[model samples]
Target chain A: MSKGVAITGMGIISAIGNNVAENYQSLIDGKKGITRVEKIDTIHKDVIMVGEIDITNEAFEKKLGLAKDNNYSRTAFLGAVAAKQAIADAGITNINKYKTGLISATSVGGMDRTETHYYNYLTEAEPRKYIDGHHAGDSSQKIAEQLGIEKSLVTTISTACSSAANAIMFGARLIKSGQLDRVVVGGTDCMSKFTINGFKTLMILSDTYNTPFDENRKGLNLGEAAAFLVLESDAVVKAENKTVLAYVKGYANANDAHHQTASSDHGDGATLAMEKALKVAGLEPKDIDYINAHGTATGNNDLSEGRAIIRVFGDNVPDFSSTKAYTGHTLAAAGGIEAVYSVLALQNNIIYPNLNFKTQMKEFNITPQLTLKEKHLDVIMSNSFGFGGNCSTVIFSKEA
Target chain B: MKKVYINSVCAITPQKTFDNTQFLEELIEYDANVINVVNPVYKDFIPPAAARRMAKGIKMGVVASKLALKESGLENVDAIITGTGMGCVRDSEKFVSAIIDNDEQFLTPTAFIQSTHNTVGGQIALELGCKGYNFTYVHSGISFESALLDAKMQLELDEAKAILVGGVDELGDHTVAIHKLVNHIKSENINSNALLESKTQGCVFGEGAGFFVLKNEKQESSYAEVVALNTYNTLDEESVNEEAIRFLEENNIEASSIDAIILGNNGDVNFDGYYNKLTSKTFKDIQQIYYKHISGEFNTASSFGLWLGARIIKSQILPEAVKLNITETSKFKTILLYNQYRGKNHSFTILKQC
Candidate 1:
């Protein structure tokens, strides 16, 4: 309990880029990944934009060298790709060395396959392999198998958009509790007609670009992505002489219980989560130098989260921005992807801009950091909220 | 750290165990490949207006949780956590099929909102108006175990006094069809009695919800103490015995001291060996119990085993139906529960009489 969890490595594949380095470059260059759907055969491609990855499922499968009979779903494919990268980035060739575990998160697990063959499963036997990958946990199990992580705590968390953050939180707790020496924590989610229409029904899908905390914001652009962080216990780090990338200083998850999809006007849950995270880190809000706001750009999230931020920081809020404009709302993968971005911000001492923000939100006098700026950052606070009133906050610090 | 205890448990399985007042005295003999829970009058626990919008998983979870809380004599918990592998599948299927059918047009928010994997936890929070630590784990067979672990940690850390935790999954046409195609669900109907010997590729698929109120302090309602729980992503059949021993040893217990062992024998021939390795060899002398035959099988079905273990500790009675062999013990003080699905996500849970 005394030794803190160390994040030794991180990997990410988002609409903005394919790897951590590419994503960092894209962020520094202010490149956004917003575009209309080109790969999936959806009629809403023209009306709804997405943060879709450039690679196709076939190419992704090729990267993993899967046999034709392999029942890897798109979600599993994305997850394996990112998880392997994280493992490699950690410089650990033998993943099974330490008492390692993998904790992945996903809201849509092999759902793309399920949706594609929903009606045709009876008529088509070719896609039958995908039938077993339909559960929310299947993709994670696949990722673990792909990583050769056997006989470990391989699991998934599907707390909607905040899922990946919760996964990271749980992984940190596991490491802290001495349950596992090292754990790969992150989330993966591929674009699906299910989530696209699901968000559309809520009237929260932005047609063009998302403007977080804007006066007249439309909504978010859903994205497909996978990101993972390799968190190792202090003893493992000491034994392996691991290169520490950053530290998962604190994390907290709280429920609003106000509404299923809506947050309270005052952001009660968000406030409690942020406050608890700060308490966990034994740091005050003033210690945070940067904040990666959840900023889904939805009418509900931005307002609720903004109020929560204001409540925590008061007059001297830290330099903050929402990177969601770069990679639309990745739902379950948001927390993991943002975690990568948070670590990157800490390493590079740069605050990524909140792309597409034009005006200050009227509900509260809070304006986001619109330009990428060079600043010395010590701790970065990231927030993620989801349906079912799930809210989570994780703080990444340069020093433990 | 204070010991975590299972204050009360309420299960909505294929059997009638919702009230916490009865055991499996009368079981519903279902002849279908998929078994649905013997539902209680949900209106007695949840409002119809609220119940109408909930998916079966959410409704069952909420109702079962309310029953557990009521039985435990608590109005609200410090936190609410739930585990579901598919999570609101009816709503997920509805939303997905609607998107494909309408070309992503005319979609309503109801199905979409309920489609999240954590909808049950969120809905429970809303119903109880409990603004506290909330989490939902969707980790397949370990989903319930993950929730239990989280609750245990919170109780040990004194962050929460009482936490409402549960594992729930519901039946849906698309899920069933897909599972059947993948052979995770039995392709053909098999007798429950012959489940373990059917030499089948898949187990009997079922839907159920099991909820428990875990408290840091022991009380009159407390059934048993959660001594320890451990989960593994993948374990060879050869390691089951060692793993069980190591788990008990870590908890400062011995294999011989375990009063009874509850195994998750879902009857999937391909995976049931993980249990057979222990029940048939390592703990051969310990009284063995199983429930999937009666509850059917689901990802979170292990929670039903926990519910049963708690009940056995409290009532000190093992229904003749759940017994694996004619072995009895004078006192039921400690129970060990081991569960896995398709030979992955193995878990060992130890519960002790309060």
Candidate 2:
């Protein structure tokens, strides 16, 4: 297999931690960030638990040093923060030195602010500034401006929960195809009344800590967070002598086509995504060290993903776990944070425990890694499935 | 690199462009600031039960994709990629209003589920049972171009045989009202025929869907060869001319060789200067074409521009309604498209006769 796109740096901000080191520490200590909603005002606050970050909109604005009257939304704030961290971690002082681009993912662009000033925009002039930030691309544009990236290939992707995975996939393809020498890719989403009420209507918002792969798994806890990864082409890596964290080995996206919001009983789309991703990586199931499962803890997702995992790995499934228990299901950012976690696992030669796994799932005999285990790791496979039957799998390896 | 071909194209625009047999044969004149698609009989394309729940954006996308697929003589493509600026805005507005007006009580999932940006792409996949690669781009004006670029890359690499790509956006009442307050929509209603002449602060807002089937293999029905495409997040007015020249040179084409240039002049005086730089200097001598007059203006309105480009290449006819300049070419072989919105997300796409 050829050398894949090199991941020079990664940064993330989730309920579990504000940076990579903090998140890794929490993972090893078996700490979770799930709690009651604190940021957004919602009627379901008592009935729904979320992995909400502690930072306030004002605090973020202050940190970014924006003007007092700036119209930055929570989504844009989180995305800019995470993307800036990624750029800084990459040790690149000049952003436009090479042909660079940004690909961001977000399901809720500026809805947090939109929903807040929905009616106020008509009567109040102060809140009307947010009307320009309502589109899903506005956050990406803001992030790009924050990074000083100009007149380049900057775009946004929104494929529901699998959005960030597709963003990373597209970024990898861009580098592999020589479209850009460097690219920053990931996703961000802030908690909003729109999402909380939306999931509530679907009856998928768990009122307690999410339990992944449990027979009595309640449901997924919605979260708000952002994460970004910096991918560099092989030429840039060699010329700059950059420290390679890991290589994006393979990625694939497939549609379940079974339902609008539900996965098929057999996880046909998930199975195909995994199988195709492995093929692209030129690796076999036996070669994978760990599997970062898309165990959203939702009744439909866990079962469907579990079955797809079994279908791909057969009897000898690799040790796998879901980090959602620590950060909840962060919607668009789930794939991005999980990717960071997968890279951390490969670098440390460790497999994170599926934090809230309890009873074994009855449908399958397989179970997730229940405790932290250190092993010689090389390749890891990560799965992210979302609404609209969008399923994606991305493989990372220590060796290109 | 393999050549990517636009095998078939279909669009449901403000004009009567849905029927592939007709190419802008008749234009619908609208005197409103906010215009809607000249909708086809959606029931003829979708089942009543499924059609009832689908928002206008979804219906337009689904019908356009089906028609494009039918014209390509394929039951399903290997992947479905879509782009939208404000995806299912109607549903999103409904859900948000219900959350606020109802005090978050007794709401259903239909509106919320359909509010996602990928709902249209997902619905098209469901209708075709296409369990392959799927993606959705939502980057304002570049949304459709982003999707087109993704499909171009995959087809060039021979990763997929055929891909279905489209862009669709629907106007929401709340969204229109908000945009009007921000001056993104025209303050006064103007005749569609006088869009460019209006010289107003904002163009008339409109909504529609445009879909195309792209494949690596050229067929008898192929409309045009997708030569090259590029997008920029930001550009100065002065740099647009230089950027256009550089883009064409990088593709090994010259300005003199371009048969026609399709400019997205939506009559927004504040931002149309980006196109004016090219029309007044770089591409002044080439055949000039404009479509926003008939299609109105939206984020994905450039997709309609692309449809016109591909249709002209296939039929070798430049409708009198879309011509912007007197310069005429004996053969419509190469065409260039330039588009931007609100002075950002600039893009250029080149199409050639196959």
Candidate 3:
């Protein structure tokens, strides 16, 4: 068997918490971070809910120690903060000591600033500073600058919700292919008026608490977050004798080719992705002890993904749950955050409850694990499906 | 290790490049700061119902990919990977403006759905009904290079047999206006032929799509063999030449062996120095070619350079319109392409005749 990519450290900033420890604490304590909108001024604030980070832009700027005229957007702020924490968590004193690269993923990017300054840019000069920061890659560039990673392969992916999953997959391939020794891979997205109104228009923004795998489930609750993981090659791990958090054993990206915004009814793409990932990991369906589903609490996603699970795992399905109840659907960052949770699950031998799940859907006989459970886990599978029929599955293991 | 070959290539740019039957035999000159692509007949590639809802970027990408697949003689590919710097900015602008104008009331999902960066790739996959690997890279200038690297690695590993890779970007009025405000778009309109001589602060903004079918095995219609590709987030003016030498050395190539080099010179007086440094010193004797004068400048404009390089290697004909210097090479065997936006996202790509 081939040696797997080693994940040495991880960092996360979400509605549930600001750091890895806090997020772990909230997950174990059954704390939910979903609440009514507080940061953004939108007309639907009363009718819609979100998982917004409590910190403000000024607070983030202050924490990062930026100049008064710094043009870093919320996406950049969150990405840099999380990536820096990941670098420190890995206990690397010199970022450039080993050949390292940063692959960040984002959907909103600097849209928050763009939407705010769209009109102002025409008449004023101050907001024009942010104009350069509007593209999807700007946040990644800023994050790289903050991490002190220069003259390295730095890129950004934006496959909607499956972006971070793809980033991790690509990072693993880079390591496996001997392209780089160390790579920091994850995704970041901040709450923005553009996305808020975008989802609102799609009619997928749940007004109440999102309930995944429930017959009465509404749509998803939008959230903003950033999460990152530091992946090192076997050579680097051996040289440094690092603490391997987990092994990124398998990953696959598949297109449903069914719809633009919705998933296939039978989840063909999700099934293909899970099967291919398992094949890559050289594991059988029974080998997976737990499954962290891409249960966005949306009506279409849960059904399609649940059916896909049934198609792949068949009669003998493993215990599965969705953590969106805790942090909501974080869009592009969902996969990264969920990967962190999967690692935490493998480390602690715990299974987080699918929060807010009430009634089991009639479409499938299987139901999500509604409460926290402890078990001896060896392998965990995480699924993240997105618009444009993008389906991704990443398998994590305790052993290389 | 398996060898990756460019089976077929297609491009739709500001110039009349979509036909592929001709290669810069006729040139269209413009005297504007911003240019739009010379569009192909949408009905020829996409159905009327679908084309009506599609935006310019999506249409261009879909048509270019279709043509590329046709040239490769494949009904579908194993995967689709796309790169875009701004994505469908027009739809994004439309959605955002509607939200602001309507105060988050009575908004439709069409524009919002199409604004995603992967919509082009997703659309291509859907059209082909190919449920395979798909990805989208959104880094500024290296977006297309990132995609190319991913496909190259997969092909080298024999993980995938055939992958469709492309880069596309479209201009939106609001995007252009804001860019002009920041001087990313030239302040004054200049003739296309005078782009380099104008010595302006910013480049003439343009948009287009370029797609290629990459396979693990060489084909009868192969254009070129992708030798090596690398990208850097930052490279100073002084270090660019040194980095170029190091890159060639890493690939077991010598600077003297290179027959031609494609440089991304967008007529920006400030950033074009990145290319000028090579033209004057390191690669002074090599045949130099520049295309942004005709294709205009976009984030993925380097894809045009790649298209030109692959065509030259296959056809062994260097168009006069793209020649930067009078230096001529009798045989087009090995070509190197260097591109960057502003001063960041530097890339070096080497292509060889198969």
Candidate 4:
């Protein structure tokens, strides 16, 4: 049997907090990060709330010690900050010591700058630096450079909200196949007029705080953040004597093949992803103690993911909840954010509360965990479904 | 370990490249800043009802993938992976402009749904009804290389026997306008034959889709063997040569062993130096080739380079239009394709004759 990949360290910077410790504290203290928008000068600032990080672009630039002329986008800056923290937490001072690769996921790479300087490029020569950084891979490239990774397998995945989860899944596969000794896998996304307006056009942006698994649920609140994890091969873990936080036991990616954006009426993709993950981990549904659902509180996602959960676990459903209400929907960063939450759940044996839940979903009898509960958790499953009908499930366990 | 071989290849680029039997017999000359692909009869491959909702990128991707699968003589594969830099830009622009124009009210889900980066892969799966592993990578120029790496890993690990992989992108109005504003697109137009000599600034922006069917077992239609693929997010022009050498060395081959090298030259005065350094230095004596002059430049244009490489290896003939130097090999045994976009997302792919 194949041993699980070891998650030696993790780091995250979101609307809630700057690091893992702070994020965990915020979750325990029941602090929801949703608030009025302050970063982007959007016309809908008064109409829609967001989980915007309080840090300014100047602050991020200062934190990275970059020159003023450097063209690091806000998305790349947040990604570099979070990825650096993850590398430090993993105690990996020399990134090239082993065959290491970096897989960073982001839906918005440098659009914040592009949108800001959209019309300035022709007249102003100074803003031309950002033009080269507008592609989705530019953010990942910046983070890789900051981490001192060169001439290695550095790539980016953008599958909407499931991008980071797929990055983690690919990182684990690389390690398991002996292609890389160590890998940094996660995702980062900064708020942009592109996404904010995009979601608004879909009519999925809730004006108020989202309520997941509730009959009166409206939609999701957009958010911005970055999260990363250091996944190491078993050989590296044994050699370094690393403190294994949790094992990436299993991961599966399945497509709905139903519609471009909408989930299938029966949630076929979600069910397949969960089933495949359980099989890969050599575990049963009953063994899972908690589930970090992809409940964006949007009408489509909640109902589809809820039905998938019910179908996979049958009557023995675990204590599942969505922390999206706290952090809002971070798009590509959603998977990484929840991944950190899952690892923390295993470490603390505490299931996070699914904030702002008043009633059960009308479509099914499934109900999310509303209040934080202390329990001896061994295995936790996390789900992330995205546009393009992409569905992914990742299982994190205490033991490999 | 299962050895994955490329069974078939299909490409829809600015040049007449869709028909694998012909090699750039006719090319579309564009004087404008933006270059659109020489479109095929997409209706023949996709139904009108289903094609109505697809963006140009999705349509190109779906048709290219279907053509590739049909050429490979396979009904479906166990997995599908795709790469795109600017994914469904038309829809993205539509959604963004609608939100701005309509004051963020009265919006629908079609454009927003199609704007996701993985729409191409998801659409292919939906059309084939193949519920298997699917993934989409959207890293700049390395996007397609990332997909290739993923497909290679799965094939070697025995996870799947057959897989479909492709890279696609389409030009959007706002994106092109912003890119022009930033001078990422060429300011002065140049002839396709003189792109290298008239290197002024910025690349000639174009869009296309290229697809390939890879299987563990080699068949009669197999074109080439995927030896190795590697990508670098950032590599200085000074280090590209060393990196390429190291990649080949690690694969138990040498630069001299490569029968031909396909270079991605987009006429960008600032970044084309990277490719020039290669063609003028260690690769000077080797049979050299280039394609961006005809295909134009886009994020996934390297997939066109890969298509050219695979065809060269299979057909064992170098098209005169693609030849960069007079030195020619009698037999095309091994081919190396190097691609980069504006000095980012550098990738090296090596294909061997099966």
Candidate 5:
């Protein structure tokens, strides 16, 4: 069998926690982060609850030591912080010692800044500095600059909600194919009036705490976050004698080719992605110890994803759950944050309960894990489905 | 590594290249910095309902993908990968400006739904019902090359048999006005034919979609084989020559093996030096060509360069309109392409006659 890509370190800054430790603590303690909007002034404040990070731009700038004249958007600032923490956790003293690359994903990019200066650009000059930072690559470039990973392959992926999953898959392949010895793979997205209103237009913003796999689930709550994981090849791991957190055993990306915003009735894309991922890992349906589902608590996602899970696992479905109730749907960063959670579950021999899964779905007989369960686990599968029928699955294992 | 072949290409640029019968036979001239794509009959390809809510970028991507698939004689592909710098910017601008313009009330979701960077790629997959690997790259100039690299790697590994890879970007109203303010767009009107000669500080902005079907095996329509691909997030001016040498060397091909060089010269005086560095130093005697003057410059405009490379190899005829120098070549094979945007995201891709 082929050796799997080894995950050395992981870092994340989501609404639930500022780093991996806080996130793990919250998960074990069942401390939810969903709340009413506090930072951004929006009229829908009454109707929407978000997994908003309780940090201000000024505070972030001060922490990152960003110059006042710096044009770092909320997205870039968060990404740099998470990426830097990942490097430190990995104990990588010389970033350029090995062939290194960074593949950062983002859906919001610099919209946090662009929307603020959109109209002002036509009349004001001070706001014009952000004009160049509006593209999706800008945030990735800033993160790359912050990490000092220059003259290497650095790119950004924006496949809606599954963007970070694809980034991890790409980084794993890069190491597997000997394109690079080590890589930093993750995603970053910050809440913006643009996305808030965008989700509002779709009418998918949940009014209260999200309930996943429930019959009366209303919609998803939008969240903002950034997460990163350092993936190193076996050669690099052996040379550095690094401690491996987990192994990315298998990964796959398949489009539903179904609808633009809605999933297919049976979750064809999700089924294909999971089936293919199992095949890549040389495992069967019975091998997945737990599943971190992409249950956004939306009406369509839960039903479709539930149906897909049933289609794949038939009578004996694994102990599956979604952490979206804890952090809302972080869009592009969902896969990254969840990957960290999956690894934590493996390391700690625990399964964080899928919070807020009260009632069973009417369509499917499968039920998600509703209580915190302590079971020795060997493998976990993470599923992330986004708009455009994009479905991706990554399997993590404690063994190499 | 297994070889990947470019089986089919469809481009909807400012030129009249959409029709297979003509290959830039008549160059369309434009005197404005911001030029829109030569419109395709969207109704012919899309339905009324889908086309009604579709943004210009989505329309171009769907039509271009359809045309490429049709020409390749494939009903559906195993994967759909697309690249766009600012996806559906017109919708982004509309949705954003409306948020401010309307005080964020009573705004519908159509514009916002279509504003994502992956909208074009997602819509293409939905149209064909291709439930395979789908990805979208949104890096500025190398966006197209990133898509190409991903497709090429998959083909080499036999991950997917046939894949549809494309680059699509559309012009937005407010985006154009703001770019003008930043001097990213040229100030004075310059004819498309005289783009490079103007020696302007900024490029002539343009928008279009280019799609190609790549396969692991060669077919009757196979024009060129993907030889090598390389991208750099940053490449200083002096190291460009060494970089080109190392890229060709890694592929075990010498500079003399390069029959023609496809240059992405958008007439930007400052960054064109990267291209000029090669022309004056190593590839001076080789046949050189450029296409941004005709296709106009966009983030993924390098796709147009790939389209032109395939056509040159298959037709064995170079249109005089895109020729940079008078040096003639006896044969056309092993074409090298180099592209950069304002001295960032440099890419080098090579193609060989199949």
Candidate 6:
């Protein structure tokens, strides 16, 4: 693979854990964060399972050291916390030393606040502070402010589930084009009644644990999370002597163009994305060491993605698994958190088990990794497909 | 580096710009704080089955994209990128209200599905069956510029030959009411032509969509070449000009070379000074033009500014209505467009006549 953008650091806060180390420990211990929703008040709370973080909005605000009158939404707070952790992990003392940028992805934005005060904003005065925070970019703006990144190219992408993956891709392109020396790219999304009810209408929220690559798989559990990675150029990495976590070797995005919300029956978009990613990385399917599948466990996604994987790898499929059972489907942050997991996989040479799988999928002969296994993993490919038929595949390698 | 060309441009704004041949010859004047697009009979481009489910934003975006594709004479593009400030606000409003009013019961998936910010980009891709790179940006005022920058980079890198880029935002009743409460919408109605003179604190909020086919290789229909584009998330009064001049310098162009300037003057007295700074100093001698009075101010209103720049360069005519300054230039080679929202998310785009 070409000398790719170096991922100097990564940080994540999800239902499974609040930090990278905790998340890795959860993965090895086979601990799932799926449980009944405790934070949001929704009618479907009893019928659905979710990967909700145990922290409250007040706690997140306190953690970020923001004033009580601050307009930091749950999404922004989560994004700021994760981004700060990433900068620290990269061991950067000064943010303005280099031409740095921030690319954040979030579908929810401040909708958590919006939904809570939807009607109250019209009648009450206290909740009116969130009126300006309703858009998808507000959270991104807050993230940039928290990172102390001003006069920079800070933007947000809202491609639903694959948002963070696209953010990472855009950041990588910026680095390749010499637009910026360092970039903080990732996605953040907080669970909201808007999304909970929206997905409830789609009838895709599982009542029990999600089972990926299983014949009896029902649907997915909604999740809330924020994950960010600090990508620095080779010159910056060498100059700063940053400890590289992994390298973004290849990335590609393709539209399914088959459905507004569902993937193609044949996973044509997913296949094309993977193919283009491999071509971009100048690697073949055999070069892949692990596949972090976008297996939402939804009947449509798993089936379509499975067929697409088969078409890409044919008979020599890599050990693949989906961590959704542990963290649920974190909408836009799915790709970002999955990327952290992919890096961890490459760093530790360990494959995480796909929990809740009891039966083999009849549509394809391939199955997910069922147990935690230590193996030599040099390259990992992570997939993230979202609403709007946005499909993305990002490859992470141990060596740049 | 490959030069990216604006091969074709189309817009469905408050004015009669949808018909490319008519260069805003007759403006549809409006006297309202919340203006809407002069509706295009979407049935001409979209079937009833599809149009029935679409919100105004989706319909405008789809039809505008179809017109762009028709003008470019291309069956499909290598990529489709869209930018929307509010996504499908009508649908979002509907879905959100449904959850509250109906107690989160009996809600269907149509509105929620269409509420995603990327719905327009995805719909265009589905229509063209263009499964190449698809991206959606939703960063307030610079949303459209972000998409343009992304497409320009891809074309510059020869990663894609032709890319469909668009920006769309539809006003929602609830959203409008809320904005009015926040003083984001003007309190009093005023003539469209008198927007800048209104001395209002808020803008005449509007909704519209603009789409263009950008290609790496210049074609017969190419309007102008995209020279350079940059966006800043935050900029104070002290650094706005420095950043803009620095951006121009990086493009190896001097301020004197710019023949015409397009400024996003949305009539918000507080923020309009950002443009005035350039008008009073940096670009005092150049021909100045603006179209927010005609297009109305939306998050992606700058897309209309882009469309205006392309039209001015291609036709080499400064429309009397859009002219902000009396000075005239013999050449309309390079047009610089700058836009920002509430003094944030600033974008500067330079387009040269090809």
Candidate 1 lDDT tens digits, B1-354: 789999989999988888677898887776667888889998888889877867899889989999999988999999998988778889888987887788777778888888888889998898899988788888878999999998998898787899999999999987787778778888878776667777888888888999999999999988999989999888889989998998888889978889999999988888888888998886898899999988889989999999999999999999888888777576899999999888888899999998
True contacts kept of 5: 0.77
The Cα local distance difference test for each model comes to 0.89, 0.94, 0.94, 0.89, 0.91, 0.92
**DockQ values, each candidate:** 0.79, 0.92, 0.91, 0.66, 0.82, 0.86
Candidate 6: the clashing residue pairs are: none
Considering only the true interface residues, what is the Cα RMSD of candidate 3 after superposition?
Answer: 0.6
Instruction: Indicate the residue-level lDDT of A351 in model 5.
Output: 90
Give the winner by DockQ: 3 or 4: 3
Model 6 DockQ vs. reference:
0.86
Badly placed stretches (over 4 Å) of model 4 are B28-33, B100-109
Model 6 stretches astray by more than 4 angstroms: none
How good is model 1 by TM-score?
0.98
lDDT per residue (tens digit) for residues A43-77 in model 1: 77888889999999889878999887888878898
TM-score of chain B of 2: 0.99
Per-residue alpha-carbon lDDT of model 2 for B1-354, expressed as tens digits? 899999999999988899999988777888989988899999999999889979999999999999999999999999999999999999999999999999999999999999999999999999999999999999999999999999999999999999999999999999999899988899999887788888889889999999999999999999999999999999999999999999999999999999999999989989998888998997988899999888888889999999999999999999999999897486899999999999999999999999
RMSD for each of the candidates: 1.6, 0.8, 0.7, 1.9, 1.2, 0.9
**Tens-digit lDDT track for model 6 on A123-220?**
98887889999999999999888888988899999999999999999999999999899999999999999998888889998999999889999899
Residue pairs that clash (backbone atoms under 3 angstroms), model 5 = none
Per-residue lDDT value at A237 in model 1: 85
lDDT for model 4 comes to 0.89
Instruction: Give the TM-score (vs. native) of candidate 2.
Output: 0.99
lDDT of 6 by residue, B1-354 (tens): 899999999999988789998998887888889988899898999999989988888899889999999999999999999999999998999999999999999999999999998999888888888899999999999899889999999999999999999999999998998888887889999798899998878898998999999999999999999999999998996677777788899999999999989999989988998998888888888999998888888999999999999999999988889999898486899999999998999999999999
DockQ of 4: 0.66
Model 2 interface CAPRI class: high
Candidate achieving the largest DockQ: 2
